[model samples]
Target: MRNVVYMAVLLIVANEIYQKPDMGLGVFMLVFTLSRQLQDITSKLLIGAAQFESDINYMKIFFDLKKLERENIDDTAELIENGDIKFENVNFSYPNSEKLVIKDLNLTIKSGEKIAIVGKNGSGKSTFVNLICGMYEPDSGVVKINDINIHNNLTAVRRSISVVFQDFGHYEATIRENITYMINVGMQVLKNYFN
Candidate 1:
């Protein structure tokens, strides 16, 4: 639609220029053509500005998430080695919500221990997992991996543990890409261990 309007304007000016090659018609055509081009350029500039702003916002979020993933690597790695985890007087609630999900929860697991958490829907089981994964911080108290405070040494704490959420999604991407991403994460865990 915009292109058609521009073309129509250009055709009208071209017809006038063809009818008379005089100074007045030439001046009019030049001014009209300049005005039309200026409008188109301004419109494009505004759209480009909006798109650039959106791109910057998206990049900011991406970088923030990456930083968090790096911070949690340590605790996750430690958990892999010892298979121990503990929550000490932990309390948690979702952001902007008044209800508490986990309240003063205390739990511990020994190295090489196998444990299962059973609860009905909305019974804070998922929220507890999220707390362990560093997705949400406890309102108070501590989550420890192998007796290390997760908050104090986030990377170290994260390196000690790994989690597979029941609600996790499988990407629509190829199997190779999915497996590669997981392996890359595992390699990162190895690096954390050696360092």
Candidate 2:
């Protein structure tokens, strides 16, 4: 496009020069204006191309993330109703880290029992919880619930465990909806009204 514009401007200048030399000044001004516009257009095209490349890269990443998360593993038919949990000789370290976050950790909690893990910051407290939740596997140990290895029935184990974060839900929802969200619709009447 720029080449075509340059050629047209050149022809206009050449025609003006051949017909009337007095018109040379106006022709020079026209060529100057056209060149400036062409430069601006070229810059805009370059910027737009760069922006499109960036957007395409982000789109590829988005699709890749969706592909990674599309797990087809079916949940186990066995339901883990019991709350029993155990971690025996569990050793764990995060990816690409040599430091042992939890080493030789051994603990057991009976069903219907409640216990709190206490430690300062960076004390493997969160790691222990992740291990119990089946979010992470041990390096060379076993995590059990009801004498059933958690790794064996990870889906069932996860179904039996629940974790509540500090920022657990969206803040934009109404107070009534937020409060009653536990049972999204407690009864058929409420479900019909929501529908």
Candidate 3:
């Protein structure tokens, strides 16, 4: 609307200058051209803003669904009294990838078992952990926690395991916030250290 008003003003000024045969006719033409260019710029900005808003709406919907799934998993985790992990004939391919990363893999970890997973880079080591952490689902087969399917009881499975990734990032927040965020514990532990 503002752009339309500015364009209208520029046209009126250009018409007046032309009718009067004034020396300022060149300046009016320049102003008119500039106004038209500005209108085009504003139109593009509005279109970009609309696209951004649409993207944001999609993200919100995705996050909301994720939150609901997380809540359901947490509820299921609370029911588990023992910890166990199992992967049965699992297969997965990344989005848009032509190759499968894990093909018909099977593994089982008993409650309180200590296990080490070793593989070369891009050998699906991280992919296996990600699957266990509930970050990605198997394209086929099933993962179980304590004999219960991880798909059916994701919360319990996640609660039974802790993982520290090799590619973990350091938070640049205050020391207190960083520790609290990582441990997800109260601030009282830091108070004694800081004191």
Question: For residues 89-158, could you state the per-residue lDDT of candidate 1 as single tens digits?
Answer: 9998888998988999999878778778799999998888877776678999998876767676665545
RMSD vs true structure, all candidates: 8.1, 10.9, 10.5
TM-score of each: 0.51, 0.53, 0.52
Candidate 3: misplaced stretches above 4 Å? 1-81, 173-177, 184-195
Report the lDDT tens digits of candidate 2 across residue range 79-116. 68876688889899999999999998888899889788
lDDT of 3 by residue, 42-145 (tens): 88999989877766764575446435422332422374667678899999999999699999988888987888889899999999998987778989988787
Instruction: State the C-alpha lDDT per candidate.
Output: 0.72, 0.73, 0.73
For residue 144, what is the lDDT in candidate 2?
Answer: 93
Location of the lowest summed lDDT over 10 successive residues in candidate 3: 68-77
How high is the lDDT of residue 171 in model 3?
50
Which stretches in model 2 have alpha-carbon errors above 4 Å?
1-65, 70-72, 167-195
Question: Candidate 1 versus the native: TM-score?
Answer: 0.51
- Provide the clashing-pair count of each candidate structure: 22, 0, 2
